[model samples]
Target: MEKDNFDEIIRRSIAIRKKYHELEMTHHGSEWTVEEDALAYLTDAGLVGRDIMSQQLRWPKVGSEAELEHKLGENIWWLIVLAERSGIDIKDAVHNFLDKTETVLK
Candidate 1:
């Protein structure tokens, strides 16, 4: 994707996180804890895994590509939020991974 698209995705993810935090504060009296966010992130990851399996099995009602993409995006959002909470720069982490992979591949 283009830099613009990636930046937009990050912007949208942050916005969604902010909205969820607001809703949680309104209904639950506080925002979600890091642990809660991690658990939710794992749950979404599991759903994505299930979707992949269903697609591999050619299930009649498997999640569509768009649905999978959305789930993956949500997972990314959760990961970014979790990293931020943990005082990690997710962009740096991603770059590190990419750099390592590139070195190994080359």
Candidate 2:
């Protein structure tokens, strides 16, 4: 994707996170801690894993691909939120990971 498209996605993700945070604070009386967010991410990851297994096993009615995509997106959203809470820029973190992976692979 183009840089502009990636940036737009990031902007939208940030907006979504802001809205979620507002609702969470309003209803739950506080922002989620890193640990709480991590648990949510893990839960979604487990769902994704289950979906994958079901697909592999040729289950009669596996979870929809859209469901898996939604869970993965939620995982990414929580990861971004956690990084932001820790004072890290999500874009920079992604780039750093890519750079490190490239170096390690070479």
Candidate 3:
């Protein structure tokens, strides 16, 4: 995809999250914590192990392909939001880092 396409997708995702927040506000208007949100996503991703790992994550069933895929897909929205909130354009960041790596590894 082109730069414009990525930008549009990011923008659309932001809007979707904004709408989610709006609906959430209608129920729990006082809640607003980015740290908490990130933690929630981390748990959803099943990366919260050991100190926070649940049994399902530590021991998946033999045919649990869909569960793994769902967990992986679920946390990306939080990452996208984190990048946006930090004023770090992911496209530029990825391109710059890749370019640096390419040059140094050459």
Candidate 4:
């Protein structure tokens, strides 16, 4: 993806998380704890796996490609939120991981 597009994704992801945080604050008395966020992410991640399995017919077909696409995006959103909550610069972290992994593989 283009740099600009990646930046937009980060921006929008944070904005969406902030909206949820606001709701959590209103209903739960505080925003989600990091552990809670991780659990939620894991739940969605599991759904992604299930969706992929269904698409591949490894399991009973339970969801469509559109559901898989949505879960994938939600996982990305969760990653962004997690990184942000941990005070890590996600873009730089991704770049560094890719660089190191590529060098090792090469």
Strongest candidate by lDDT: 4
Cα error of candidate 3 at position 96, Å: 2.2
Candidate 2 per-residue lDDT, tens place, 1-74, comes to 55556567667777887888799999999977778877887888888787666667754445557686787778
Q: What tens-digit string does per-residue lDDT give for candidate 4 at 1-106?
A: 5555888889999999999999999999999999999999999999999999989988787556889999998999999999999999999999999999999999
Query: lDDT, candidate 3, residue 30?
Result: 54
| Model 4 alpha-carbon miss at residue 18, Å | 0.8
Can you rank all candidates by lDDT, best first? 4, 1, 2, 3
Can you list the residue pairs that collide in candidate 4?
none
Pitting candidate 1 against candidate 4, the one with the higher TM-score is 4
Quote model 1's TM-score.
0.80
Segments in model 1 whose C-alpha atoms lie over 4 Å from true places: 1-3, 58-66
Error of 4 at 60 (Å): 1.4
| Candidate 2 stretches greater than 4 Å from native | 1-4, 58-61
Put down candidate 3 lDDT per residue, 1-106, tens digits, no spaces.
Answer: 5455767767877887788778778989854477767777777766524213333566544545555555654566667776776788877887899999999999
For candidate 2, list the clashing residue pairs, or say none: none
Worst lDDT run of 10 residues, candidate 4, spans 1-10
State which candidate has the highest TM-score: 4
Rank all candidate structures by their TM-score, best first, as comma-separated numbers: 4, 1, 2, 3
